[model samples]
Target: MKKFLFLLVMSFSLMLILAGCSGSSEDSQAGGDEANSEGSTEIEFWTMQLKPTFTDYIEGVIADFEEENPNITVKWVDVPWGDMEKKILSAVSSETAPDVANLNPQFASQLAELDALVNMDEAVPAEEKEQFFEGIWKSNSFDGKTFGVPWYLSSQVSMYNNNILEEAGLTGEDVPTKYADVLDFSKKIKEETGQYAFFPSIDGSHLLETMVTMGVELTNEDMTKATFNTAEGKESFQFFVDMYENELIPREVLTEGHGKAVDMYQAGQLAVLSSGPQFLNTVNENAPDIYEATEIAPIITGKTGLMNVAAMNLVVPKQSDKQDAAVKFSLFITNAENQVEFDKIVPILPSIETALEDPYFNELPESPSPEEEARIISAEQLKNSEVLIPPMKNYSDLQKAMTDALQAAMLGEMSIDEALADAEQKWNKALQ
Candidate 1:
C-alpha cells in the first residue's frame, strides 16, 4: 500500500514536470537563446524551476559557453514540480532525454535500475569531490558508479519564530541542539504557550535529522535494507508519539507537509520548524512582516549530537548525447556564484565546500534578530548525519513503506511495532 502511494506521487510529479514544458511559451526566454552553434550540435536540457531561480544563472552560464564554443546550442525545458519524475523517466526511456537533468539521489537509485543514468566517474575526479561535505559526495553514487555531480546541497536547517520563543521565556540559550532537546522544547512551548515546539515530520526523512542525532542510520552499513524499522528507528518514532500523546505537538503536523510547517512558523503559531534554507524565500514572500522574526539554526542535539538531511544531487542520464557539455555546465552551475544565487531561494549548502566556508555561513539574512539568522544555518551544527540509501532498485518503494509505517503510527490505527512488521514484510517482497 505504501509502495502504491509513492508510485502515484512519482507518477503525478512526472506528469507535472512534462506539463510545465507544455505550458512554457516558445520563449520563456530570460535572455534570448543564442542561435545554435555553427556546427549545429544541440544539447537538450531539462530542469525543475531553475530559471529566475537558478535557471537565469544557468542561462548566463550557457550563453557564455555558447559564445566561447559557438558550436553548441542548448534546448532547455522547464519542469514544474508536479509530475516531474514521470516526465524525467519518460524522456529518458523515449530517447529524448536531456543531456543534463536536475536529479536527486532519490531518483538516482531507481534510474540506475532503469538504465537511465550515465556513469561519469572518470569525468569527476575523486580529488574534486573532496570539496563537498563528507556525506554529500556519496549521495549521488550508484553501485560504486558516479552518476551526478554535487549541485547545490543543504542539510535540514532549524527554523524558529523569535517572537513566540520569547513569549515562552526561551531565548537563544534555550535553543535545543539534540533530538531529545527538540522534543523537550516542543513540550515546553506547548505547556507555556500552547504553540508547537518543533515538528519532526513522519512524511519523510526530515525526521532523519533527529534519528541521525541519535546515532541511527536510515540504512545499514551494507545497504541491503531499510534498517530504520529497528530498535533505534522505533525509539526515534516514539519520540514523536510521546510528543503527540503529551499534546506537545499539534496533531495537524501528522498530515501537514513542509509547507504547512513554514506557514505555521510564518504565522507565529509554530515556535519551531525544520526545513531547508528555502524557507527564507517563503518567509520573505508569505509573511513579510514576520520575516525579521524568522531565525535559522542547526538541528538540536540528541544524546549523540546535531543531525540533518545530507543534500540534493545533480545528475546525468545514460542517454545524454553531450556528456562533455553536460559536465561543463554542471560544474558551472554548482560554482560559488551560482551556489549563492541558488541558496537565496533553495538555501541548501552548496556541494562546493569552499562555497560554504566563504564567511557566508556567519552571515544571516535580514531576519528578526541575530538569533534567527543563527537558527537557519543550524544545518552546520551536524555532529552526525545519515545518508545511506543505496541506489537499489526499490528505494522509492522502501521510503513509502517507512512513511506508511510512520503515518499509521501517527494515526493510532496500529502500534509502531505492528505497522513496521507489516512494512518489513512488504519491503522484503519488494526486495525479491
Candidate 2:
C-alpha cells in the first residue's frame, strides 16, 4: 500500500515537472542550437532573493566565470522568495528552466524524486565533493544520489541574557546544553529572575527539528509511513507539554513565532534565544542595552549532540542540455575562493573546508563584538550540525500534521498519546 502511494505521489509530481514543456522545450532546443552554432553554450542561472543587495558580487562572479570558461555564458536571474517556487515550477513545466538554481532541501527534494535534477555525485569530482561539510552535503542527497551542491549555511547559536542569568545566580558557563537542562534553567529563571528561560517556537519547523535532534525517527526507513509516536517522540514532546502546563516556559510559545521571541528577548523577558546569529543584529540595533548584556553559547543539543543546520544549494535540472557547463559554473561559484568572497558580503558560513578555514572565521580580535562572537560561535557549531529534516517529498505536510498534533496535546484537548497517534494516522493518510 505504501509503495503504491509513493508511486502515485511520484507520478503526480513528475507530471507537475513536465506539465507544459512541449512548446517551450522546442524553443529551448532551438536556442541551444543557435548558441552551439555560435560556438558557445548559454545556460540560465537563477538565484532566490539575492538581488540588488548582492548584485555587484554576483556580477563579479559571473564576469570571472565567463572569463575563465570562454565557451560558456551564464544568463543570471533573481527571483523573489515568494515567487521562486512558482517561477521554478513554471520554468520546469515549460522546459525553459535555468540550468542551475538555488533551493533548499524541501523543494529540491521535489525535483530530485522526479529524477529532474542532475546527480551531483556523478557530476562533481570526488575530491571536490570532499571539500564540502558532510552534514550539508547529505542534505542535498536523496536515496544514494546527490542532486545539489551545498553553498552557504547557518546554525542556531545560543544568545543568552547575561544580566538575567546573573540575576538567577547563573553564568554563561551554566547555560543549558540540553532540553532537560533548559527546563531546569527555565524553572530557576522563573523562580529567581522572573523571566522565561527560552521561548520554544512551535509555529515554525523548530518542534520537528527538535524531535529529530533528540534522535526521533519521524518516518520509517523508506519514508512511506509515519513512525513518530514511539517512546522517543513521546518523551521529547512530553517535555514541552509539561513545561507549558506548569507555565515554566512562555504561554505565547504555543501560538507565537521567532519574531515574538526576538521581541521578548530584546525586552529582557527571555533568558536565552536559540536562533541564527543574524538575530544579534536585531538586538544590537533595536535594544542596545540588552545587546550589551547578551552573551553567546553553543545551541542546546539532544541525544544526537548536534545542532540543526540549514543551507542554500545549487542544482542543475535534468532537462538542460548544458549539464557540463552548469555543473562547472556551480562548482566555480561554490569553490572555496568564491565562497569566501561571498561570505564577506553576507553573514553566512561557507560549506567548503578551505573556506571555513579563512581568517574571517578563525582569527578573532582581542576583544570581539557581539556580532563577531556570534558568528565565530555559530561557525564552530557548523561542524557538529546538520539539517534535521531529512528529504521527504511530503515533508511540509508531515510537519503540519506533527505540529497540529503537538499543539493539540499542549492545549489539553487531547492526551499526548492520543494526539501523537492521531497525527501519525493523518500523516499515513497523507502519504497515501
Candidate 3:
C-alpha cells in the first residue's frame, strides 16, 4: 500500500512536469492573443472544494473584484478536493490551467520546482507582503523565492473531555501544555479510567511535524542532506516507540490515520483530541454529549514552543497570460479586509496581520461556545505557529521513510539506532 501510494504521487508529479513542457507553445500563443485583443481580459480562477457552502461569499468577492477592475473579468471554478491534483494537471497539460489557483504549499512547491509558477517575491511588492504574518507567508516560499500568497490558516488546539478528566480525578487545569507531560498524563488517564489519552498517528506527516516541534532539525540549510540522525532525533523517535511498546496509546495508530483518532474521540474512547476548531462542529453534530463535555486548551508543544499551522495559499501559474491580473486577484482576496469577511463565514484564521487583529478573532461573547473558544485560542497561537514541515522536493518520500523506520522500531522489528540509521540513509539518497 505504501509503495502504491508513493508511485501514485510520483505519477501525478510527472504529469505536472510533462504538462508544463507540452503547454509552452500554446501558452505563448495565448499571451499573444490576449495582448492583441481589446482592453478586456478574462482570467480563470480555481478553488478547492468550497462550493455550495461558500458559494455566495466567493461569488460576492468575485463580483467586487470585477467591479473594482472593469477591464479584468474573473471566471471562478470550484474543484473537489480529491480531484484537484489530477484535474489541475490535466488542465495544465491542455494549456487550460487557471490564471490563479488555490493550492497548499506542498502542491505549489512541485510547480515551483518546475519553474511553472511566478515568483511572488518579484511580482508582489515587499510592502504589500508585510501585511501577512511572516511565518504564514513564508510557507509558500521555496529556495528564497515566494511562489504563493498566504490565505486562511488553521492551527491545532487541544480539546479535552471534561467528563473523562473528572473520571480520571483530573481537572481542566491538569491538562498538559507540553509534550513532556503528555506521557504521564496519558498513563494516568489510562490507568484510572481505562481510556487512551490521545492518538498520535504516524500514518502521514504528523510524525514529521511532531519531531520538528520537538526540536529535530530535518535538513541542512540548503536541504541537500539529512540532519535528523542526532540525539534529539533519536529521543523524539523513542518517545513514540516507548508509548506504543508500553501500550499507552492505541495499537491502531500504527496503521490507521487521523480519522480513527476523531472516531475514538467522538466515542469517548479517547480523552484528549488535538485538532482544528473546524472539527468541533462535526463533534457537536455527531456526538452532542461529548461535545458538551469538550473543553478547549492550547495545543501541546515541545520545548521550542512552536505550534503547527495548516494553510491554503494562492498561486499564479507562469503559463498564464494574465499574470499581473492574477496576482492582483490573489492579493485582493487574501487582503486584510477580504480575509476578515471570510472568517465570518467559517472559523478559520486569516493570514493577514491586520485581519488577525480584527475583534472577531480577539473578542468573544459573554457565553461563547467551545468552538468559539477554540477559535480564539487557535488564533492566539498563529504568531508562534508555522508550517512545521516546510515544503521540500521529495517531502512525501522523506515522511514515509521516517514513518516506516519509527514503526519498525516500535514493533521491535529493528532497534532504535538501526531504524534511525536506515531512515537517515534513505533520506540522504532521496536528497541526493
lDDT of 2 by residue, 351-403 (tens): 99778788899778987887788788888887788888878766667777888
lDDT of 3 by residue, 1-432 (tens): 243554565576666555664465356445542532687889899999999999999999999999999888888999999878777666765657789899999978877876778889988998999988888888898988899999999888889999999999999888999989989999999999999999987777799889998999999988999999999999998899889988999999889988998999999999999888899989999999999999999998998999989999998887787787888899999988989899888989899888777888889999889988988899899889989988887877888899999989999999999999999999999888
Clashing pairs in 3: none
TM-score of 2: 0.91
Tens digits of per-residue lDDT, candidate 1, 8-103, equal 645644544334333321232232232344545677777776655666667876787788667777777888866567676666545566777777
Model 1 TM-score relative to the real fold: 0.81
How does each model score on TM-score? 0.81, 0.91, 0.94
Point out the higher-scoring one by lDDT: 1 or 2: 2
Stretches of model 2 off by over 4 angstroms after superposition = 1-16, 19-36
What is the Cα root-mean-square deviation between model 3 and the actual structure? 2.7
Query: Where does candidate 3 stray beyond 4 Å?
Result: 1-38
Q: Cα lDDT of all candidates, in order?
A: 0.64, 0.84, 0.87
Best by lDDT: 3
Worst 10 residues of 1 by lDDT: 25-34
